[model samples]
Target: MLLPLVWMISASLMPLSEVIKVPPVWFAPDKYSLANYMEVWSRVGFSRYFFNSAFVAVTITILQLLTSAMAGFAFARYDFPGRNVIFLIILATMMIPFQVIMIPLFIMMARLKLVNTIWGLIVPSMVTAFGVFLMRQFMMGVPRPLLEAARIDGASEPYIFARIMLPLCKPALAALGIFAFLGSWDNFLWPLIIINSQKLWTLPIAMSRFTEQYIAQTHLQMAGASIMFVPILVVFLA
Candidate 1:
């Protein structure tokens, strides 16, 4: 696992000759250079792709958090007809692969003219089954008496949700946020299928094109791989 990363970073720092050497030489940064990174960053407008991916990923994470939190809270706290069945149906979506629905989803996006747009990337991600399930489990652990006490004190559901539940849900929210953000950041297939313009391309799209355009250029490819890895690492650390 660490070996590939070790090789990538090592290769990113190496010259072309060392990058593709047989048997894969490993050494300290004795003669490493930042030239490959600088070259890649400057050549293909990577900054634009970086921002596109960032915007889409962050938007999806925030929207998913809000929708999941509210829906899960309602499911856990409210009493209603067929609530269990409805929740079960939502969870059932997790069993279905995106591949199964891709064409229909694409047709819907095409009709809405969301194809080739950032919102195209964001809309489908706004809420997810696992997210709802995660939040519900966390919200379930929250004491019901506490909510009832707040109700007795004249607090509304919205107030209780915002002030009491949200604060208590921080750890779970953090966990879900990280997963959601990372998933969006690394998403490739839908973006490739939807985006037609180069200007609208995300990091993964740009990276794929970069690989095709610069085939077998190992050092530059490693640098590109490093570029893709940085934001995820930063988000995880934060």
Candidate 2:
């Protein structure tokens, strides 16, 4: 695995012709150049694609954190009628493949006039049942006595959630945020269907096009792939 990854990075810095030689060239001729990187950036408007990916991923992460934390808090700490049934329904939704609902979701987005926009990508992903489930599991480990003490001090539900639960779940929040961001950042199929404009293309879509347009230029394609991996690598390292 490390060998393949290292070779890919090395290849990305090599000249285009050397990449597909009879035997692969592991390194550039003399010194590595940023020519492939610059070419990909210019040809694909990669900066715009990067911005689009960042916007979608960040928006999804924030919204999922807020909404899932609240929903998780309610499920973990509060009791009401049909609470189990409601949670079961939400969990069931997680089991249903997005592919199963894609058509209906597309129609809903079209009716809302969100198709071809960032909202189309961000809105549907904001509420994730898995996020709620993960957060609720984490929140369950939190001491109820602390919440009771907060309530005794006249702290409301929202205040307790804001002041108490959130701070305690930092690790889990980080884990969930990383998961959500990666999911949104790498999503390609839904974006391809919903987004009609080149300006709205995310990294995955842009990379796909890059490969297709530069099929003979393996070095350039590898550079584009390397750029896509940078954010994910950073998140994992963090």
Candidate with maximal TM-score: 2
Write candidate 2's Cα lDDT for 148-206 as tens digits.
99999999888999989999999989999999989998899999999999998999998
Residue 45 in model 1: shift from native, Å?
1.6
**CA shift of 89, model 2, Å:** 0.7
RMSD per candidate (Å) reads 1.3, 1.2
Question: Residue by residue across 68-141, what tens digits does model 1's lDDT show?
Answer: 99999999999999999999999999999999998999999999999999899999889999999999989999
Instruction: Please report, as a residue range, the 10-residue window in candidate 2 with the lowest summed lDDT.
Output: 24-33
TM-score attained by model 1 = 0.96
**lDDT of each structure?**
0.93, 0.90
Winning candidate number (lDDT): 1
lDDT of 1: 0.93
